[model samples]
Structure formats: C-alpha cells, structure tokens
Target chain A: MENKYHFACQLIREAGQFIKGRMTSDLDIEEKSGFGDLVTNMDRETQDFLIAGIKARYPDDAILAEENGVTHDIKDGRVWVLDPIDGTVNFIVLQDDFCIMMAYLEDGVGQFGLIYQVMADKLYSGGGQFAVVCNKEPLPVYQERQLAQSLFACNSRMYAQNTGGVRQLLDQCLGIRMYGGAGISMSKVLSGQLLGYFSRIQVWDYMAAKIMGEGLGYCLLTLDGQEPDFKTRQQVMFIPKAKLTEVLSYLKGVTI
Target chain B: MENKYHFACQLIREAGQFIKGRMTSDLDIEEKSGFGDLVTNMDRETQDFLIAGIKARYPDDAILAEENGVTHDIKDGRVWVLDPIDGTVNFIVLQDDFCIMMAYLEDGVGQFGLIYQVMADKLYSGGGQFAVVCNKEPLPVYQERQLAQSLFACNSRMYAQNTGGVRQLLDQCLGIRMYGGAGISMSKVLSGQLLGYFSRIQVWDYMAAKIMGEGLGYCLLTLDGQEPDFKTRQQVMFIPKAKLTEVLSYLKGVTI
Candidate 1:
C-alpha cells in the first residue's frame, strides 16, 4: 500500500476506536440546525485530534473536515476528506450505526477510502489499485443480482416524494430499507448486504463511500448520469455495474 | 401492578435483553409473505418463548402472536396480544429500532401495554390504572409543546399517499420522522420524543403502543375516530391529547 494511504487507514482506525470507547457514556449532544441535525462535543474534539495529527505528520497535505473547514494549500495535489463521526444522531442516541470515514484524493482523483463501523468493529478500506478489504480480508466486487433479488437503502421522505422512481426501483428490487443513517447504509452496500443505495446526500456523506464503491468495481454515479463533483453536494446512487443500466433506465422514465 | 401485568413486564424485559444480546450476531433472516414482509428465526423463537411462558403461567389465557397465529380460547375476560419481534426488518438488519411489544386486553379493552427498546434498555409500559413508565419512572404527559414545535413519527408510504387522514395530520406537525418500524416509532411518542404518530398499521403493530400511549395521557385513536378492535386490523394514530384535538380539527377541514 502507498505510505499516505496506509497512514490514512491507521488514523481512521484510531479515531474509530476512540469514538467507540465513548459510545455508551454521557455525551454533550446539542441540536444543530434542527432536531434531526445534531452535533456532539466529541465530534469536534475528534476532528481536532485527527487534524492535528495529520498536519504534524504531513505538513504539505490539504485537509477537509466537518469542523475547521479546509486548510493547507490544494496545489500539492493530495487532499484528505474526513467526517469524524458520520452518524452523530446514532452516536447521541447510543445506537450503533455511527462510523468514522476518510477519503484521500491525489491529483484530483480519488485514490483511497476508509470507513470504520465503530460498534461492529468492521473496517472497509481500499486504494483504487488495490482490492477492497474488510477486517483485513479482500472483499470482492459484489456479483450482479437482479433488482428482484436486491435490497436498496433509502430515506423515507425522499423515497415517498419521488414515488415514481421509488416504485419503479422497488418493483425491480427485492426490497427497500430505510435505516436512518447514511454512513451505515452505504456500509451495507460495501459489505454486500445491500445491492445498491440512492439518496440526496451531502458531499461529506459521499466522499468515502464513493471512493470505496468505485475501488470495489461498483458504479457510483450521479442520478443524472454526470460525473460527481467532490466539492459540491449532489444526489448520488451507487450500484453494481450490471444493475446500473437497468436502474438508470427506470429512473429516466420517472417524472422527477 | 396487577399480577398478570407484572408478569408481562418481566417477560418483556427478559425478551428485550435476549434480543439485544443477539443484535450483532449472525441471524437466520428470510422473507416472509411478500417483499415488504420479513421473518427471522429469532422472531419465531422469541414468539415461541413468550407464548410457552404465558401458557404455562396462565393456562386459560387466550394468546395471539405474529408467528403462531392465535391459540387457546378467548374467554371474553382476558387475552394477550403479542408481537415478540415487532420490527423484524430492523432485527434482521441488526438496526437498533426493533422492540419486544405486548398488550393485554380485558373484555376486548386494552388493559396493559409494554414496548421495550432493547438497545436503549428503556421500557415504556402502562395502561388502565397505571401511569406510563420509562425504565420504571413515570412519564408525565407532555402539555407544553405545540404541534409546530414537536416531531411526529409516520409511515413514509402513507405520507406519500396523502390519504386516510394523514394529509391533514402532516400539515399540523413540526416535522415527520419515518423510522420504518411501528413499535419503535410509537415508543418515541410514549417517551415524548415525538408529539404523535399516525400510520396505516395492523392491530398487532399498534396494540402495545396504544395501551402505553393511553396510560401516558396520550390519545390513541383511529383516523376515522372509532374505537380500535383487538380482533381486527385498523389504521391508527397515537398522539398527546392536546395535539389530538388540533389534528382532529385540521383533518375535519380537509374533508377526507
């Protein structure tokens, strides 16, 4: 593995363990924009710890994190995107779906990705050139499953509002699951428990998963079939390539 | 507590802990009747455990459960309605929203209820003369929050249908939360986390929560404003009394 990629994995594992250790303790959880949006003091503290360690070891690398925003220069052609605690709500509620995620971009291309499911102690990580690994074992790109045999992760409101798309997708799939946490939903896809997932998500939500999905030979694309821009928020869908054509074709027919 | 009610609580607590212990372990998950329906070995096993224990202790009691159908004879004086694993999908996926739910009906009237959030280790139980309790502490009916300031739990598909009184109810709430599990969603209402919850649900799904909500000074009513039948399925809404009046007025104006 590349040295920087290895370093990123090690940092993510450490951060994940740190969060897990505090999962059941009293957390300083505060409402953010709304009841649905929450932030914990632990989130900020973890971000600070990771950022400081990364900056000290790699002074020239660019960093983008949930807290402290972006720092360092981008001209170095390598950037680290981090979400210290991806499912803050789950963490606050003492639920176990929360995760720590990291993605490394080199020369404007996603080179490596890591997602650590804290409570389950499962780490999914890979570089584009290397096979995806789960708990140190290689995880192959999932084989194609028919929509009637596959499970899709989705959010309730979005799925309901876009009924035409959802119905079509549901008709083709074995079932639709709404688990309430984006990181864990995507992790299900990565772990082969889910065949695909579609959602209107923020950039931070997609960063790590997109890289991991692509590295594992799954197709991660914008719903509109455009190249996904890492810097801007977008609606994205990740599916195995064989299922992609069918899903996109079905979605195209929907009014939304 | 009545002797029967006390026994019910003990059984629910034990079953809840049993389910929690198995949350992350391998489960024999399988589809039940259709796409949206799922069944697990744990679901059947839990149901059997509850049914056998109930029968052994109260030999003459009529029993109803998700897996075993109905058993014994309805003596018109006492009946036990049970959903051993209320959110099978949540349980199958190891999501934390699943619960062990039970309701007792005396002369076809709900007399006792229990909804145990196994992962959180919180049990919401009550009915008839007893006040609702969370972890054994009585919870007062929330009287301060208005509809505009409270969260509401709802089924996503029902929200999309915009029918059966949900359209009017949706306009009166601060926001809607779709957690995908009826037992888990109603537990939130009993705990004051949600001001109310309305969905097209079966009797098995609402019996336990309905009993608990009523004991907590919340209103559990049908959309059409009729008494729920323990022997039949119905669409129900469980809401705090103050909000119920506001929601009823809103629904009347919609003319549905």
Candidate 2:
C-alpha cells in the first residue's frame, strides 16, 4: 500500500465529510455553459479544498478539473484530475445521488482513483495493483452474467436523444438507470449491480473508476471500440470483461 | 390527522426497520409471472406482516396485495392495497433503492398511502386531507414551470418500445431519468424533484402517492386522459395539476 493511496482515501473521506455537513443547507447553484450542466459554491469550494491540500503536500502535481480547467503540465508527470462534486445536479436539486471524485495519475498512468458517494458511507477506490473496495470490504464478484440480465447505467440525455442504437439497447436490457452522476454509475458497475454504464463523459468523470475497475476485470472503452484517450471526453462505456462484446455490439456503428 | 394515517405511518416505519435490518443478507428472490417482475421472501413476509396487522385491527377490510390476491369482499368497503416490496428487483439485486408500499382505499376512494424508501430514512407518507411529507418535512411547491425546465422520470422500456409519442416525449423534456423502481419515481414526482413520471404501473404502485399528490394539486391520470380507476393497473402518470395538459399531450395516442 503506497502512501499516495492512503492519502487519496483519507483526503476523499475528509472532503466527503465536508460535503455531507453542508449539503443539507440551501445551496447556491448556477448552470454552466450547457443547460443542466450545473455548478455550485460547494463545488467550487470543494475543488479549492482538494487543490489546496494537494498543493500543500505534492505541490508539483499537475491538475485537471471540470470547474477550473487544467493546470501545471501533463508531459509525462504526476497529475490529479478532480471534480469536487461530480453529481452537482443531484446535489443541488435532489435529496441524494452525488459523489466527490479525484484521480491520481503518475507519468500519464492512472494510479489512484476515488469516488466517495458522500451519503452512502462507501468509497469506491482503486489504484495500481490495488483492488477496488466499498468501505473496507472488497467488492463482491457476481456470477458470470449475460447481457440481457444486466442493468445499463446511462445519462438521460443519451436515452433522450432518441438515437437508433440507444433506443434499441434500452429495449434489450433488464433496465436503464440514471442516478445523475458518473461516479454513482461506475460504483454500480464495479460492485456488480450493473452490467455496464455508457455516457458521453469527460476525463474527471471516469478517471479513478477506470483505474479501480481494471483490477476487477472491468473495461472502459469508447463507443467506437477504441481505447479511450483520457485527454478528451468521449462517448464512453464501462463494462465487465465477460460481457464486453455483447454490450459493445449495442453501441457499435450507432453514433451515441 | 386521521387515525388510519397514523396507523399506516407507524406500521410502515416498523416494517421498514425490519427490512433495513435484513436486506443486506443474501436474499431469496424469484421471478413472478411477468418478465423482470420479481418477488422475494421478504416481500411475502412483509405482506403477511401488513395483512396480519390490518386483519387484527380492521378485520373486514378487503386486501389487495402483490403476493397474495384479494381477501375479503370488495363490493363496497375499506380496502388495503399493499405491495410488500414494490421495488423487488432493486431489493434483490442492488445495494439500495427499494420501498414498502401501501394505500388505504375506502369505498373506491384513496384515503391513505405510504411509500417508505427503507434505506434512505425517507417515508413519503400521507393520505386523506393529510399533505405529503418526506421525513417529517412538508414537500415544496415550485412556481409555474414549463417542459424545457423540468425533468421527466420515465422507464427505459417506454423509451425503448419506440412508440411515437413516448420517443418524442423522451426527446423533448429537459431530461429523462429512470431510477428503476416505481416507488422511487413516484417519490421524486411527489417531492417536486421531477415535473412528472410516466409508467405502466399496477394498483399498489402509485396509489398512496396519488392520494398524497392530490392534496398538493397533482393528478395521477391514465395515458388516455382519463381519471385512473383505482381497481385496474394501467399506463399511468403522476403530474402536477399545473403541468397536466402539457405532459398529457405527449402520452395520448402514443403506442407505449
């Protein structure tokens, strides 16, 4: 267990505690450039909190954030991609369904990724050879599953777009779910509650979960069946290794 | 408050406590007659628990339940509609998102309804002249809203079915969401987190919320633009009174 992993876990727990404490109050929320793309004072403060902590200890680490954009460098050095509150809409509007997200990338490799669903008392965390675990318990490995029996976690926008492939995929699966945050959906995929999750997601959205999921034999791939370039957001999916082909077939050739 | 409403709340709280205590263990779940319809031993026991309580107190009350069929004559008497576990799929397969549901109808009128989202400490409860409240706080009412500003809670099956009106509705709303359980969706609608919810649901599914929503100036109507018959399960929707016609235009004449 490296110190970085310990720091990642502790830092997220602290951030989560801060979020839980203040989220009950009336929050100041505003929409970002896109409709339904939301931001809030808590999100900004949480980002500042994480950045301040990282800068205090590992001052040279590069940062890529949803609210503040990129900082430092990514020419093969340590970088932390952070989205202080990943499900801001759920946070601002709904009673639940939000997460605090952060990922540690070393030399362009995802080392530690953490998604702390603040209210659930479970931190879905993984990095390096580390296995993803909820709270202190290692994630359970479910029985080998078929595509038809699995749930798909997706954003409403994708389903609402009325795309040909998405419409077909919605009909074929056990169900489609949207909990309003990438980290929340990824937690379901890692824990075997969902067979796969697809979304037009950004870098900070799937960074840590991608690192955590790999150890459980899960994969995050683009809809076009290419390995994802973390530098840019794309129509991406995370599916179990056993069911990749079946899930991919639903997304192939059909633009998301 | 009516004594029946108090009884409904207390009974549901106790049942919810029992469910929360036991839900984490491996469950014994089996499929019902319909595809994706599930029932667990907990469902049966909870049904028995509610029926026993009601029978002991109001012996002649007719009961309509998910696990057990109708009991006692229902020509014109008090009826208790109960779905011991309304979100059984979520209960048997996931970490959270299941509820204990019950509605008390007298002479074909919904008098009391309760939806207890067990793990989340939320009991969206009320009936008769009682107002709906979540965890003892009254639900908030928003100003007049339009389609573009509201989230529509819907099932993927509806979107997947590729019906003309549902597809168009899916594309038109500000966003769409499917939380996988009818109880969960109805809870969102009652609390104003969603503008509306559409589903092909059964009697016990939205009955309690329908009772509660009515007091809040909300209406639960069949897709065909008729007042719902409490006796039959239909393609139904719960929409705020202010947004009824707008949402109705999307559902009427749609194949879904």
Each candidate's interface RMSD, rounded to one decimal?
Answer: 4.7, 2.1
For model 2, how does the per-residue alpha-carbon lDDT over A116-139 read when each residue is reduced to its tens digit? 988787898875777678887888
Enumerate residue pairs that collide in model 1: A147-A172, A147-A173
- Candidate 1 docks at the CAPRI level of incorrect
Model 1, residue A39: C-alpha shift (Å)? 7.0
- What's the CA RMSD for each of the models? 4.8, 2.8
Tell me the tens digit of each residue's lDDT in model 1 across B71-117.
Answer: 43333767887888776765554365688888888787788888887
| Model 2 chain A: ten consecutive residues of lowest lDDT | A68-77
Predicted structure with the largest DockQ when compared to the true one? 2
What are the clashing pairs of model 2?
A: A113-A208
